[model samples]
Target: MSLLLSPFDMAGTPLTNRVVMAPMTRARALDDIPDDHTVLYYRQRASAGLIISEGIPISREGCGYLFNPGLYSDEQALAWRRVTDEVHAKCGRIFAQLWHVGRMSHVSIQPGQAAPVSSVAVVAERSNAYAWVEPGKAGPVQASTPRALSIDEIQRISGDFVSAARRAMDAGFDGIELHGANGYLFEQFINGALNTRDDRYGGSIANRQRFLLDTLDALAATIGAEKVAVRISPFGRLFDMQPYGDEAETWISLAAALSARNLAYVHLSDQLTIGAEAIPQGFASQFRKAFRGTLMAAGGFNRTTAETALAEGELDLIAFGRPFIANPDLVERMRHDWPLAEGDRATFYGVNGAVTRGYTDYPAYQADASL
Candidate 1:
């Protein structure tokens, strides 16, 4: 049997296959609550062995996108329960990705129009944030300069993560995945160029890792270590992330930390986006060596590449982002070697209340395509 099609146990959860639907933000939720559209969007992709939901802000302060969902409130958790129930009814396992945008946000998305908070007071250049100051005016806006978070604020934010994890469990999610990648709050804290703080949460690698480590420990305590997972983009410069000299050491060290905790998996968000550089050829092998747990690699993986990676044992599982977006039945399509549909770029994020157009409206493969 092809390794990609084989069933495996992810931590303690049994998976039907090795295909993972990588998380992508659709921004369909309003008032930080998941709606019916959100439920259908995830239900359509229930065939994936695992589905990681898009970045969910832990609090109002954690929000960056206008319509992105949150987990800090009972209403939001109740709304999410519908999503989790539908996915589970369809025999799918899903994880919520806890997120905070940090300095990559505009004032409009911040509480009371306050400055976005980060490890350092840095302004990301050439970055656009989704801010809805006025209901119809929500689109790409310049990222605002952020204020450095004090130790008290840092502890508060970490507590927010714990609360979100507990809320995820209450909402019936199978597990929770920490959004520690792609130039978000956690990544900002780890990047030396972005984190210029002199306290326990910055400076040396150990210090830089304190926030993430502490959060992970807290989440593990709240939701069990076996159900915790994290995603990281080691050399990512997205959202105006500056290159750091200790990139390799920082990421490898973080991986070791995750391994020591025996989390479900460590998701590597490699250079998979358009025009992004792929991680150096042997880096995955090196990462797998240092981290002795399941490793899921995301970013532009096709069936052949994913199979090869799994067969060679470089990765325990493979995550498909764009493919899953275009083809809800991505696993079945890949299994049958069927040509996949392409998702509309315009609708990838959302257009007015037409979020369902590009989300749940994609059709599955039909026999006519082969003729």
Candidate 2:
């Protein structure tokens, strides 16, 4: 049997297989709350060993796009509970991906139409935020210039994450994965070139990594460390993240730091599939050596590559993003060597007059009756 199809234990969580459904933003939550459509969508893809949900904004201020489901309210938590119940009924495990987009946001989508806040007062050049273009209109607009977060505000945001994590547990999530990658809030502070602040949250490598580590510690204190995971993109240039000195050392040091925390896992988000530079060669092994725990990576992986990585001990689990969109029975399809279906790009996001059109309309693979 291929290792990719074998069962594995993630911390104490038992998985039916080693294939994880990587989080992808579908943007179907028109009201910033999970609805029946959200339940159906996840239920259809429950075959994945574990499902990491789409980036759910921790608060309105953390949101970068319109129509994203959030976890900062009781009503939203209640709605997500329904989705989690259904997925659990199918014997599937799901993790809530807590997200904060930081400056990757427009004032139009921000609360009170205020400027987005980040580690510093810089704008992401050539980056776009999915927000309002005009009254009652929505589209991609240039990300707004952000104000630097004060010390008090930074602490407040960390508290917001802890609050969201508690809500995630109430929503019946098996665990919570912090969105620390892709030049988001965490990366905005981690990147030395961008975060030039002369405070405890910036400057030296230790200081730069303080925010994420401190927040992770707080989350672990609130929820068991075994129930917490994080996703990061090393050397990622998404949203105009500039490569900085000590980039390699920064990531490796973080891996070593996280190793001591005894968390669930460290997910590496490779940017190759998203049209950004790929993670440097041999870096996964370097990270694997440092982290010493269940390590997962997602980007341009198929069954063959996944199995190869697992066989070589480079990755304990493989995460599939776009493939899971059209192939709800992705694990079974891979197990039986069935051909996969492609998703429609046009209907990947937004309601488009039919919420289920591209969201839950993908049929499971059926063997030919003639056979």
Evaluate candidate 2 by giving its C-alpha RMSD to the native, one decimal: 0.8
How close is every model to the real structure, measured as TM-score? Answer: 0.96, 0.99
Q: Which residue pairs come into collision in candidate 1?
A: none
Question: For residues 1-371, what per-residue lDDT tens digits would candidate 1 score against the true structure?
Answer: 78998998998999999999998988877666898888888999999999999999998888888888889899999999999999999889999999988988988778798999999998988887898656667888888999999999999999999999999999999999999988899989999998889889889999999999899898898889998999988788788777778888887777777789999999999865745566767777777878999999898888889999998888998998988888999988988888999878888885556667888889888867556
Which pairs clash in the backbone of model 2? none
Query: Cα deviation of 275 in candidate 1 (Å)?
Result: 3.8
Residue 236 lDDT in model 1? 84
Model 1 regions more than 4 Å off: 133-135, 368-371
Question: How far in Å is the alpha carbon of 77 misplaced in model 2?
Answer: 0.5
In model 1, the worst 10-residue window by lDDT is 271-280
